[model samples]
Target: MTHISKYRMKSRVEKRIKDNFLRSILSGGSARRQAILGELLTQTEKIMLAKRLAMIVMLENDFSYYRISKTLKVSTSTLKRLHRHILAGSYRQILTSLTGNRADAIIRFLEKILEFRMPPIAGPGRWKFLDERRK
Candidate 1:
């Protein structure tokens, strides 16, 4: 059997994201661009993903919103809408593999989520630990 690389897959996904974002800008914010990226972030409508990619692009880039808006020809609102989802941990299931190793896959998924989470919660908060009991 042939092996697939997680790094390669990650690059592909990141490329798609960059292409979609840049295309969204160059094409005057075409509906097609929006649709393509919108679908990848949803997961049975139960999870969120892609916050890191978006943050890296927007924050690291010096381009202003108006410049992006003008370049993509999209309203600031549309870009903001997608940005919100990415930042809010709304997109999901950003990983997949051809192997049968469930444990490795889950660890990768959780890592991706944690990387996006700020000051990522290390301990339970407002939620009871499995060992904790109430009076």
Candidate 2:
């Protein structure tokens, strides 16, 4: 069996993600995007993406990494990497641009419902735990 390098695989995936046809379909509207996503992704994949988005919103709202990890059942290392991505700015920009003020309102509502407490260090690059599980 041949193995693909991570960088090469990521490039390929990113290329597909940026494809014009895919972009057109995704930009078509919520119903179009939903239909395509439903067709392309499994239920578990959709759920995982939704969870990740929720985590992103919570992180932006100042929810603690540990608290989010506990509530969402995601690893701290995953949260840390996501935090780095947010701080890197692209995801933050996309989220804000896509959701507008509604994102903030929804996050606030979720925070109240989830009852998340702020941790002492919500800053990026603080988590030291490594994800050691093999895929």
Candidate 3:
């Protein structure tokens, strides 16, 4: 859970300032970026960021809401919001960055990680047949 200050800011930062900050972060080398993020984000914040990215990746892979919810322990409402963002094409750049050129390989790997075992087929009739044959 993130804690936001109750006090509102008197003024919002300009878009250009925000864009410049983001650009500076993105322009760094991978190690520098990792170091900056490590210093900037709290552990909980990092977990939240990872989960959101995972949710987006899983959604793109066509995973069911139930599966994603069960696996990630996130609520359906969160998935719904992300889905809306996805439909709006809000995540295209983020998705591309997350998956890179090996999208198929990455998705396949995520699919394997997300896979769950289904219960074997069973019924009262089958159980009864087995009991009779044993007798």
- Name the best candidate (by lDDT): 3
Give TM per candidate.
Answer: 0.25, 0.62, 0.69
Q: Write the per-residue lDDT of candidate 2 for residues 82-127, one digit (tens) a residue.
A: 8898888858565766476777776766666566344447666334
List lDDT for all candidates, in order: 0.48, 0.73, 0.80
| Shift in Å, residue 68, candidate 3 | 0.7
Prediction 2 TM-score vs. true: 0.62
**28-91 per-residue lDDT for model 1 (tens digits):** 4568655755664454232223333333244224446665455434567766776667567654
Better of 1 and 2 by TM-score: 2
Q: Which candidate is the best by TM-score?
A: 3
- Which runs of model 1 end up more than 4 angstroms from their true locations? 1-62, 91-135
Angstrom error at residue 37, model 2: 1.0
* TM-score, cand. 1 vs. native: 0.25
Give candidate 2 regions above 4 Å deviation. Answer: 1-21, 98-100, 112-135
Ranking by lDDT: 3, 2, 1
